[model samples]
Target chain A: MEALLAISIGVLVAAAVYLMLARHVLRFIFGLVLISNAANLTIFTAGRLTEGMPPLIELGQVAPDPGVANALPQALVLTAIVIGFGLFAFALILMFRAYTTLGTLDSDEMRIAEPREDDA
Target chain B: MSWLLTIPLVLPFLTAVAAFLTRESDWGRKVSVIGNVVFLGAAVLLFSHVYDKGVIAGQMGGWPAPFGITLVADYLSAVMVVITAITALAVSVYALSDINTRKEYLGYHALFNILIGGVTGAFITGDLFNLYVWFEVMLISSFGLLVLGGSKAQIDGGVKYVTINLVSTILFLSGVGLLYGMTGTLNLADLALTVPALENQGLVTVVAMMFMVAFGVKAAVFPLFFWLPASYHTPAFSVSAVFAGLLTKVGVYALIRMFTLVFDQDIGFTHTVLLWVAALTMVTGVLGAAAQNDMRKILSFHIVSQIGYMIMGLALYTPLALVGAVFYLVHHIVVKANLFLIAGVAERIAGSTDLGKIGGMYKTAPFLGILFLIPAFSLAGFPPLSGFWAKYVLVAAALEDQAWIIAGVALLVGLLTIYSMTKIWAEAFWKAHPEGTDPTLATLTAAERRNLLLPIGGMAVLTLIIGFFPQPFVSFAETASMQLLDPSPYIETVLGEAAQ
Candidate 1:
């Protein structure tokens, strides 16, 4: 299961990087989303998948049973997911605004901040 | 002790909340200034506490060490927090004149304070995960501040800045994950204990490189620094000034911490890479600055170069070398931020930061000229200025190690820095105004003059003080470096007897 997940992450990251290299901002943002999901999966796979019950103890038990999965990475990935989602949402809107105001989605021509040699 | 540690982080947050509540009123500016003063007081208090105690740790919510989030301050963290407060105060005062009303009602002060809070949190955090959270907080608020005006230039700069930083964030997060998988703990103190025991030292080095790239982007090193000059000249001068002072320093701080405390194994391999990066960063940054005609753009590129000097100290990883890094960190923050503030004043009087367009400052506004000279000379490594001492320490550290190549690079970079500073001085201050009008201080209204010059004068005075009184500051950095070299005290303070 870990091997399969790792391969999937590799594929997702490859696709994301390919998309990220595109000239358009929206495509680049979509690449960001894919790469972010791949990062999430990287964390999950790196933590090592286990076939076990949830990390919950019985009423009188002091800890989860010995066969329980490692819950820490899950918690970490969940936090990353939430933060990544918020940042992606913000990035989407920001790129949308850039599209509207700059009137060009092409990253190459978005040189208003740093002007090109001949243009300046 | 815990109270002291928490105050620097908590005060600005409280101020941010309060300032946001009153952001629509004129009171936001008032609250920001007062909040900065309180924050500075709190930072001084924390500094004194850390000085006396050696290292102090406070567990959040009374949880035990390595279990709950810990706020730790040794000498380096203490000094950094203190400097952040100082920069915040300086920028807040300068913002009174620089930030117009539209940006103010957009909650400029609130975002500014939150950015400070995030920087403070990043400095003091004892958990790697906690540091990531603080970084996100810093990034989000900085995004707002960067794009507040939403001008064509700002939005363009904002897109590049935000996109690149988010990529760095992902790399940082993934590095944290890979590290946790190896060590089974995320508390820095705990990781410090476990990282050495891991059998896969090669994997450890890989993760370290991940951290290096993640932070390398933030620090704006060599090839990774294109986003900085593209974006920094777009923000409000006040926003740009604080960012100039605090943002890159945080990345350098993280590099120092992890390199010193957690990833001390295989210094031969890891630090050698850092040494090369340092040289290239310095060379490229100054070369880039030499080509720029805009005042802020030149200063922005110079920031990249100066970061090279700091990282050079880190790459050396000696006791005296780390001291140089610490000293340079503090001194550069003051000098760089003040230079930006002065540029804003010049822009106010002369009407542009473009060198070809603005001039006559030495003839018409000698006071402003003097203020600009302090930081400009200091930045170029001239004597009796803070930049001199900063560069002196680093070069001396390099010579002490008998690293002739690094010593040469350091001094050569200093000379190139002088060229850029002179370019600014000659074009912006010495030459007659191209439009044939003398740019005088009187052109600014009374309130504008008061608000603008006060912070510029105040920071120039600080540069003078640090320059003239280098003894105590050097000794403090020496002790801080000693603490960094031997972080057992820091680890013990955070994790108790288990650290041993």
Candidate 2:
């Protein structure tokens, strides 16, 4: 199962990298989303997968029983997902604005900030 | 005890909320300036406590360290927080005149405060994941501030800045996951103890490289720095000044922390990589500046150049070298931020930041020229200025280590830095204004002049103070470097007696 998950992560990352290499800002955002999900999967897998074991303590117990799933990585991944979602949303809006204001989604054509110099 | 550290982190959020609520009124900018003053006071308290007590660590909500979020400050973190507060205060005041009412209504002050809060949190976090969160906080707010005006150039620049930084953020998050997978611990103090004991030291080195690339982008070193020059000049001058001063330093601070504390197992390989990156960052950055005709763009590229020196000091891994790095960090913040503020002033009065389009400041505004000279010369590493001492220490440390090429690179970069500063001096200040305008400081109102020049003057005084009185600051950085080299005190404070 761990091997399978790792292989999936690799594929996701490879695809993400390919998409991110594109000049279209929207494609780059989609690539960011994919790569970030891959990262989330990594954290989840690294926590050591466990089945039928919730990280919950029973009544009159101070701690969960042995073999309980590690909850820390889940918490970290949840946080990452939320932060990544917010960033993706912002990036989407920024790309839309770039399309409208700059009139093109191609990063190469966006040269108003750093104009191409004639001397160089 | 925890509250002492929490105040600096939380006050900025409180201020941000208040500033947002007041954004419709004239009170927004006023609240920002006042809030920063209070934040500075809290930071000073934190610094004083850390100075007297050595490393200080506190767990949030009274939870034990390694099990809960840890906020810790040694000498290095303490001084960074203090300097961050100083820069925030200066920029907030500068914003009073520089930021327009339309921007104020757009919640500029709120974003600025949140960015400060994020920087402070990054400086103080003792958990790796916590640092990642703070980086996000800083990144998001900076994105807003970068494109706040929604101009075409700002949008173009913001897209690149946002995209590139997002990649770095993902890399950092993955590095955190991988390192945690290897060690089963995320608390920095615990990792410092566990990383060296792992049998898979080879894997640890690979993870170390992951973090190096993650933070390399943040620190704007070598190949990863293109985003900075692309976007920094497009922001509001106040935003650019704060970004110039505090943002990249956060990356440098993170690198220093992770490398010194947790990733020290195989320094030979890692530090050598850093050494080469340092050399190239310096050379390419200064050469990039030479090609720029815009005042802000030249300064922007120079930022990448100066970061090389700091990284050079860290790469050396000697006590004195780290001291040089720390000294350079503090000095660069003040000098670089002040130069940006002065650029803003020149743009305001002279009508352009393009050096070719604007000039004659030396004759009409001698006072402003003097103000610019203090930071400009200091940035070029002139004697008795802050940059000189910083460069001197790093070069001396390199020579002491018998690394002649790196030392030569350091000195050559300093010389090239002088050329760039002189180019600005010659074109923007010394030469006649291309359009034949006088461009006097009298062009601004009394209040505008006071709001603008006060921060520039205050920071100039700070640069001079550090330059003239290097002894105390050097000793402080020495002790900070010592704490970094041996984080045992930091560990003991965070994880308590059993960790020893």
Candidate 3:
């Protein structure tokens, strides 16, 4: 399970990197989402996969048996997901504004904001 | 008693939410001012407590470390919190006049509060992953602030800024994952205890490199710094000033913490790389400054250069060097923020930040000129200012280590720094204004003058206080550096016997 998770994370990272290299703004945002998810999975896998484990402790268990899945990584992953969502939303809005103002989604074409020779 | 640590993190966030909810109301600005003042008071209380008690620890959700979020305030964190609070308060006051003129005042204030909250959170949090979360909070809010005005220049700069920082976040996340995977822990103090025991030094080195690259990009180190000057000066003056003052220094703070605690092995390899990077960062950043014609752009480039000095002390890895790094970090934060605020005033009084269009401000606004001069010279490492003592300690550390090349680079960078300051001084203050310029540029109205004086006066007073009686601050930094260099104290305070 751990090996499979690791491989999946590697694949996700590769895909994300490819998307990140694209010239368009939306693709970059998508790339960031993929990268964040890949990171989440990587952390999940690093916690070591366990089989047949519930997410939390059963109510009123005397010993509070240790068989439940690790909750820390899950909590971290949940936070990462929310933060990733925030970044994606912000990036999407920013990209939308850029496209509306510059009339293109290609980052290379948005050169008007670059410092011009006559600026100084 | 330990709960005081939570106030610094919670108050600004609550205020931010309040500011957001009151966006349409006329009381938004007033509420922001009051809330920030309260936050500043909390910071002062936290600082005084930490000063007396040494380090304060709070375990969130009533659970001990390794199970819950922990907030720890050592000397370094406390000092940084004080600095952040003061700068935020000054910026908040300055923004009152500045933001009222803008269309997005509410969002601006909301984002500003969130940024301060995030920075303070980052400083106080003892958990490594929690630190990453706070970093995201800071970065996201900074992104919003950078593009608040939505000008073409802002949007353009914001894109590069967001893209680079997004990449950095991913890298940082990956690093955290790797470190946690290797050590089975994410608490910094726990990691400090466990990291040295790992058999795979190479793996830890890779993780360290990932962190260095992530923070290097954020801190605007030599090769990773291209995005800074491209984006920083494009924002409005307030936005640029705050970003210049706070954002990159957070990255430097992260580097200092990580190197001192988690990655103390192979100092030759890591610290040597840092030394060379410091040298290159300083040289390239100053050259970038020299190449700029605008006042803010020049200052922005110098930010990168001065960051090199702080990292230089980290790379040297001596006690004196560490003390110097801490001292320089505090000095740089204030002086840089002051310089940017002065730039804001200069633009207000002179009608532009472009050196080509601005001149002869000495006659019209001598106070502003004097305000600019103190921090400017301080930043240039002139004697009798805090900047000089910072350099003195750093250079003394390098010489003690017999690292002649690093010491020489430090001296040369100091000279170039002075040269950059002179460039601004001569172009903006000493030269004559051309004929037929806008008559409004020659003078400021009463309100504008007052708005400008508030931040300048606040920063000038700080500069003078730190410059004259630096021993107390230096002693505070020395204690902080000692705590950092020996992580046992931090670990014992955080994880109890498990850390042992």
Candidate 4:
């Protein structure tokens, strides 16, 4: 399971990188979404995946049973997922707004902030 | 004591919510200023506590260290928190007149307060995961603050800023995940104990480099600083001042923390990489500044250049060198933030930030010109000023270490920094206004003058205080560096039971 997850993460990162290199702002944001998922999967795989077990302790007991799946990475990945969702959602809206205000999505043309001297 | 530490962290958040609810009216500005005053009091209290007790650690909900969330303040953390509160209070005052009604109604004060809280949390966090969370908090709030005005330049800049920052955040998180996989603990003190015990030191070094790149981008070091000059010059002045003062320094602070605490296993390689990165960052940043004519753009590039000096101290890793780093960090934040604030007033008076278009401030507003010279000259490392001593110690340390090349680079960068400052002094202050009108402070209303000049004057006085009374501040930084160089007190405070 760990091997499969690692390979999938590798492929996902490769695809994400390719997409992120695009000049279009919207496509770049989509690439961010893909890479953020890849990061989540990496945490999931790195924690040493275990199936069919919860990290819960028995009633009134301290510490969970041995050989149970690690719950901490699951929790960390869950939190990363939430934060990434909010950030990328904001990124998408920002790109949309940029598209409207700047009238172009091409990164090269969005140069109002740092305009070419020749243009001036 | 924990509650005292909690006040600095919690009060800004409470302020953020209150400011948000009242952002539609003048009350938002009032609440922000009051919040900053109360937060500054809390920072002073925390600093006093740290000064007396040394390193203080408090676990949330009464749980012991390494098992629960922890807030820890050593000398470095205490000083940084206090300085952050000072900058926030000054910027909040400046924003009262600088940020317009439209932006205030768009919830500017709330986002600004949240950004401050995020910076403080980043400074005091005792867990690696917690630091990343605080970084996210800083990032998201900064995103909101950066584009609050919604102008085309702002959106364009915001897009670049948000995109690059999110990429860096992912890289940071991946490093945290991989480090956790190897050590099985995210608590920093626990990691310090566990990191050396891990058999795969090679993998540990790779993870450390990953962290360096992740923070390098955020820190706006030599090759990775494009987003800063692109975005920083476009934001609101108050936004840029706070961003200038706190944001990148958080990256530097993290680098110092991780290198001193957890990543010391391979300093020969890791710090050597940092040494070269530092030199290049200095050279490239100053050259970048020389090409810029806009007031904020020049200052933004210099931000990248000045970061190299702080990193140089860290890369040297001697006790005295770290003292230089600590001193330079505090000094740079004040001077840089004050420069941006002065730029805002210059723009308001002259009607443009373009150096070619605006001039004659020295004759018309000699008061503003003098205010500009204090920080600008200080930034350029003149004697009896803060930056001179900062550079002096760093160069002295380099010479002590027989690193002549970087010593020369440090001095050379200081020279070039002066050239840029004098360019502003001559063009913005001395020359006749290209439009043939005097740009005087009298043009502004009395209230605007109060809100604007007060903070600028206050920060200038701070630069002078640090400059003239170097003994106490230098001694404080020396103590801070001693604590940084040896992390046992930090580790013991946070993981005493686990380590024992």
Which residue pairs overlap in candidate 3's backbone? none
lDDT of 2 by residue, B198-292 (tens): 99899999989989998999999999999999999999999999999999999999999999999997999999999999999999999999999
Q: Report the C-alpha lDDT of model 4 over B373-458, residue by residue, as the tens digit.
A: 99999999998999888998999999999999999999999999999999998899999999899999999999999999999999
Count of clashing pairs, candidate 1: 0
Provide TM-scores for the models: 0.99, 0.99, 0.96, 0.99
Instruction: Please give the TM-score for the first chain of candidate 3.
Output: 0.86
> Lowest summed lDDT over 10 consecutive residues: which window, candidate 3 chain A?
A111-120
Model 2 off-target regions past 4 Å? none
Model 4, which residues run further than 4 Å from truth? Answer: A59-61, B497-500
Ranking by lDDT: 2, 4, 1, 3
Q: Which residue pairs in candidate 1 collide?
A: none
| Tens-digit lDDT string for candidate 3 (A2-26) | 8788888889889989998999988
User: Scoring each candidate complex against the real one, what DockQ results?
Assistant: 0.79, 0.90, 0.70, 0.86
Clashing pairs in 4: none
Off by over 4 Å in 3: A55-68, A116-120, B101-106, B436-442, B497-499
- Most DockQ-accurate candidate: 2
